[model samples]
Target: MTPDRHRLHDHLLDPSGGLVYHLRALRHRHGRWAPFHRVLAGWLAGWQPGRRELVIVGPSAGYGLPTGFLARFGRVTALEPDPLARWLLARRPDAGRLGFDRLDCLAGTDGLARLAAAHPQAAILFSNVLGQLPAPGGDWRPLLARHLAGHAWASYHDVISTTTAPKPDCAGLGVSDDGSLEAVLARFWPGGTLPLTDHDTFRLGGERPRRYAVWQIARRRWHLVEWADNTGAAPHG
Candidate 1:
């Protein structure tokens, strides 16, 4: 591995880094080798774009950067809090194409409100960061409902274990009995549902298997793209 890749791998292995490690790993694996965001942007190409804006929350180095690239069809704003990552993003060529904003964190109702105010008419995309939220008490639904009532479309992705496997039950967050992320999104966005696509599996640590479900919430319909391992989970409107 290159020096940067080795350092990133080590950083991910550190316990204190937490999910940032997995996020980094996912990014390095996908971003370095695949045109993940480009494909996602193509998927969303048909949306009305003249007056629409695209906002990305919790823009990690890997996900956020590529997301910004894919969001070129509209105004893209990236929100992040990490100083080093923010610095790197600022230095990147694509920075010119996006409105990068630094935030303390993208959790709680207040943070959402701030984002809503910053990009009122934009489509919103949330990746792995949603599950990392504090949980049901954070009340993201009302914030989402208010922002997406008629003005915006939002997309979200969450990791789900298999139906027959024992999964960690998050406190204050609901998971389905079948280990489907669809239920989680449904709980978070009551009016939203999961649209089925291809089923794919991701092997994190040999035996620790996880699945991904892509969901879109717009015009009161939930369209699902089922199961694809290593598939880029970009939110579409």
Candidate 2:
């Protein structure tokens, strides 16, 4: 686990360490974590959907960050697994335009298929939640691959396992070794991760740096991987 994950959870419980991390993400906003999310949204803004539809997965009932940004779209649907999170979100005034569903995204392919079927044209967002998806056999590529196969999607999450690259300020959340994660994504979908040029810096939390990155898989990227896997052969490992 990285220091960022712990730092993000530091304010959740009064005892300092507890299992109430969800509250920290849902309610606390000591600049807890928003700037990076808005940066992700900015990247998403590049591709404008015809219907201005955005399907968010696991926003954890947070508001005025990514959710608020997505709400600008004509339709905003969030598939969340927590009931309490949903309740908190429903209590908000701006929730008028937002739709919440109690969906366990980690359920399986069926659930994901339904999501895709319902919002075929909507851009799917897997923010900070992809790493937490329940994937048996330690392979998360399938979960993401399934989503991209059905819709245009982008991912923003923390890469815990660091490489030679330096970290950013306003730290923490999620965990994964950069090389291993990148290897898996490249193997499944080459260059699927988008490169960040100018990003925002946060100074709310201490000097801890962030090791996060954006992962993307548009229709074209999906087609290439599918074609390579179907005709030529599975992508070379």
Candidate 3:
């Protein structure tokens, strides 16, 4: 990362980052949130697929790239926790090659179970939303395990700062925290690990620094299953 990029990341990860992101999301005045989306999309690019079903939880301003790109390959079921954001997605013009679905925020284990059932065989993308959950009791592993069923793939992004520690081992799956998605995936899935191939980065346009770490992940098992070919309504662009 360049000095500029690092600076940007620092600001975004700052405690006040939520305020900054929320303000930009509220305004939609410019591409204030575009950099974050771009970096996330870059990470998804690594998991190239002929076709696959995807589930994106916490769809904020828009379905970020790579997820947008994956829409071309298969269907996408987007779950947004914020009502305002969901309303915006519902109103936005279909960009073609992409589909959108709005779900009530997954508040607890039951909610996660329902979400997992709704999009079986889909790759689940959870980005930046985990930290917002009430900590200590927030057990996402059940949700992850539910989605990981049927040879599915799931990608999660969590900000690493001076605080917060890596999660403990789960089900023999290794966990590693690097600023890169490749390193995370390798830690999650070893041996037949694919190369770290896709990435994108974005920097805040202003003087204040902010950065985002994006990642794309896929499970080898999912490749063996058949995927649906049709995606839902395309947003009119």
lDDT against the true structure, each candidate = 0.40, 0.43, 0.40
For model 1, how does the per-residue alpha-carbon lDDT over 1-237 read when each residue is reduced to its tens digit?
A: 213311222122222223554465455434432333333444345333334466665545544234445436456666654444445556666556566654422444455555655565666665444543443344444555543444444333333322221122311232223344545345434343333332221121112223233222222222222211112123344
- Error (Å) of candidate 2 at residue 147 is 4.7
Question: What's the lDDT of the predicted structure labeled candidate 2?
Answer: 0.43
Best model per lDDT: 2
Model 2, TM vs. native: 0.53
Angstrom error of the Cα, residue 111, model 1: value is 3.4
Task: Find the 10 residues in a row with the least total lDDT in model 2.
Answer: 223-232
Question: What digit string (tens of lDDT, one per residue) describes model 3 on residues 1-237?
Answer: 213311212122333123354564555423433443454444456444323666666645464543345445456666654544545555545434345554433454555555555665555655445544542235544444443344334343343221111223322122223234334443434445343322121110112122233222111111100011122222222
Q: Give per-residue CA lDDT, model 2, range 3-58, as digits (tens).
A: 33111221222221123545544444435335434444444554444456777776
Those runs of model 2 whose alpha carbons end farther than 4 Å from true positions after fitting are 1-19, 25-28, 32-41, 44-47, 63-67, 161-237
